[model samples]
Structure formats: C-alpha cells, structure tokens
Target: MLLPARTLRFCVATAAAAIAVTVGLTGCGSDDDSGSATGTTATASTTTAASATTGSGQAAGATPSVEELQTTLAILSDPAKTTQDKVAIVVDGEKRATNIESMTKALAGYGTLKFVVSDVKVTGDTATAQVVISSPNGDAPPMPLTWQQVGGKWKLSDASTCVLLGFAQAPCTP
Candidate 1:
C-alpha cells in the first residue's frame, strides 16, 4: 500500500519525539573517556543529572523509556496542538510548513496504525531508532529511523525524512 504523507509523518514525528526525549534524558554531554579516578566521580554526577530529568533509574546517557516515547507521540498527534507546534518537532520545520495541512488531512485516514519501538541506538549526536508499524493490513517490517540531536533537541535527519517520503538517498535540503 502507498504510504500516505500523514501516516509517514506520524511515524517520523513519533520517532523524532522519542529521540527528543532521549536527548532530554541523556543530557547534552557524552561520557568521559578518561580512566582517571576523578572521571568516575564525573560519571556519577552525570547519572544523577539524568535521573533527575527522567525520574527513572536510568543511568546517564541511557536511552529513554518506551512510555516516555509513546507519550510524546500522543502529544504530537493531538489536534489541539498548532500546526506550527507539530512542525517544530519535524526535521526540517520551515521546509515542511507548507505541506502540514495536507499531511494533517491524510493522517485522518490511518487511525488504526500503531507504532512500536523495537530498539534505539545512540552514537554521539546521532541515533537510530527501530520502529514496527502495525495497521489493519498487517504489521510492517521494522524500520530504522535516523535522528540527530540539534540545539539540545532531537530531530529527524534529512536523510530519514527523504527515505520516509520515498525519495532516493540524495542530499535532501529538507
């Protein structure tokens, strides 16, 4: 079946929101590679900071919880949120503004679709989240989503959006 823009955007938005949660949970710093004993202390502080943000027992730099991710998706899907708000969660916000209306309309058709996070792998400022989408037709195979941490928020990478929109892997501006 053809993937409608709204449906694809829903997946992308969900993944992006989840990644953003990861950023908030993990903080904007990477683990120190120093073997010095003092570095261990620093690690503890990082973990404490992460725990404060997530309120879970998650260690510093750990992935976000599945529930947090799902919550983000739910918020984004709310019709009460403005188009500007929804677009802000997208990878290329300004570029996507023009198409938000059409995409929102398309979203109305696929109410049965569900997104399940399979795994999330983070490396530096980039992350790959695997998601399984299920609908009336059946469960779609797992799809790996690419996300980038930008200005302390997680957003979809241009490449991921391009692929989701059925474009070739080229240098996409949006």
Candidate 2:
C-alpha cells in the first residue's frame, strides 16, 4: 500500500487545512501473506480553493519573513485549533479545509512542531525557500518549497499543493 491505513488515520485529520506536509494516500494495496500494505498515493477531486479566503488565504501584505511563516505554521499545526478555530494556514486552504478532521488527527501524536527555513527568495508574487520540519520524533528532510503571493500573503504554490496532495511531482515545476 502506498500509505498505511493507520498512518492515514493518524494524519488525515486536517488534510491540507494545516499544510502539515502529510502526504495523502489514494489507495492502499492489499497485504500479501505476510500482511503488509503495498504503496501510497493521494488524489482528491477538490482541487481549486473554494473562495481562497480561509486562514491560509490571508496574505502577508508584504514579503513574508521566514520567521513569520514558521510562526504561522506552528499555530496552524496545533491540533487544538480544530475545536478552537478552523484557521488553516495552507495553499488553497478552502479546498484543504474539506479534510480538516484528518489533518487534526495527524498532529495528535506529535510533539511541538518546528520549522527552519533558509535561502528565502522572492520574485513578484512568487517565492522559494529551503524548509525543514522537525519534532521530537524525527525531522523531515529539508526540501525546496515554492510559495505564491495570494491576496497579499505568501501561500504554498500550486506545485506544492500538487505534491502535498499526492499528485505528480512534475506539477511542482514552475
């Protein structure tokens, strides 16, 4: 299976709502005699942002600082936000909001989430950066991320949306 059922159950709590980087799994291959899933891939029908005004849609009004983006993500990643507020800091947040419940669950077992960003670059309404997500459990490998200036704030680029949502890697290309 591409994504284990247990992993999906754990991370799909808020889906893209939190932009937590939990890749979606479209299907899980049946287990062989040994009893193990086969592969993981994520696909979703809801692609476009519903209105683009979800918490993720709000713009920064200026070029976003790496620290600012990290702080916002930390707040959005909080599992408590599910009941307190549904302000998801992600790209096309309205579309991602559809899976808020799953995203929330993904954060339940994690410790405090931390992000380190470098090589901030901005050009017009687009930007790119090196990012790493870390926690007590483990640290995600650093990767380059593309961001878009939406409604004056920096949001994950569509390419990022494609990757996070379990779509093609080529979609990440400019």
Candidate 3:
C-alpha cells in the first residue's frame, strides 16, 4: 500500500524516536573491558551538544531562520561528525556509546544518510523536528530529534535513536 507522504514521514519519525529511546536507556560498554567506559560520557556530551546545536532553532532572545536547521542536519549527517558518538536520554535513564569510530565503520557500507525534515515545531530555543533518514539500502523509519539553544547556538539534545547495541535504551513513558 502506498502511504501518504505525511503518514510515511510520521512512521519514520516514530521509528527514530523509538530507537533513540531504546538506546538512551541501555548502558554502553563491551564485555571486553572497562577502559573505554570513560569514552561514553565524553561521547554522549559531544553528541548531545552537537545534536542540540544542529537541531536547535532561534534563541529565546533571537530568531534563527530555518536555514540554520537545514545546515545543522547537513553537518550532522557528515561522516566526520558521525564520530561524535551516539547517546539517548530517556525518561528513566540514559544510554551512551563511545565507540563511534566502530559504529561509523559498521555503517560505512550502508551508504550516505539523507535526512528529510517533514515538520518542525519550535518554541523559544527548543524545537522538535520530524525527520526521516534514507540510506542506500532503504529508508529508515521517521524519528523525532530534539534540540536546544545554548550560547546562541542550537545543538541536538537527544537523537532519540542511533545508539550503539549495548548502549541502546528502552522507550520513554508518556
């Protein structure tokens, strides 16, 4: 069945949000060692900051154009920025993965990531964007990405998805 563009977008967004929540609640680590544990916090912080900045909208005292968001997505999708790690913040807990380099390697053959912004809701320095990512293999489900403004810069607050395996978390409760 052919789904409406809006419906398709929503589906993708929902999937992304679900993944984000899952990864956020899960702990990050490999069975091998704990030396890399410290990397989790650092990576999470960086990812959160970058996501918030990229997805963020206008500041409480200023107005940022939509172009800013577009630019943010572009930068986030870049392979270079993908090294920022993957983290999720859930209602009950937080999940983080510091092995971003590994994740990138795994996704290397997955093809480029193309994000489509279906809709955006902005309030002050915070905003929730409905986005869908398409890969060479296929299109991923839609996901909700949260953003916040800090120091007049917008960054990702929570990707809601894209967490590493062990670092994945459960969904947040409504």
Candidate 3 or 2, higher TM-score: 2
Best by TM-score: 2
Model 1 root-mean-square deviation? 18.0
Give TM-scores for every candidate, taking all chains together and pairing residue i with residue i: 0.51, 0.52, 0.47
- What is the per-residue lDDT of model 3 for residues 35-71, given as tens digits with 9 covering 90 to 100? 3211110001011222232345533534334455544
Candidate 3, residue 102: the lDDT equals 43
Instruction: Show pairs that collide, candidate 1.
Output: none
Best by lDDT: 2
Question: What's the CA RMSD for each of the models?
Answer: 18.0, 14.4, 11.7
Task: Locate the minimum summed-lDDT window of 10 residues in model 1.
Answer: 39-48
TM-score, cand. 3: 0.47
* Candidates' C-alpha lDDT: 0.46, 0.47, 0.43
Better of 1 and 2 by lDDT: 2
lDDT value, candidate 3, whole model: 0.43
lDDT of 2: 0.47
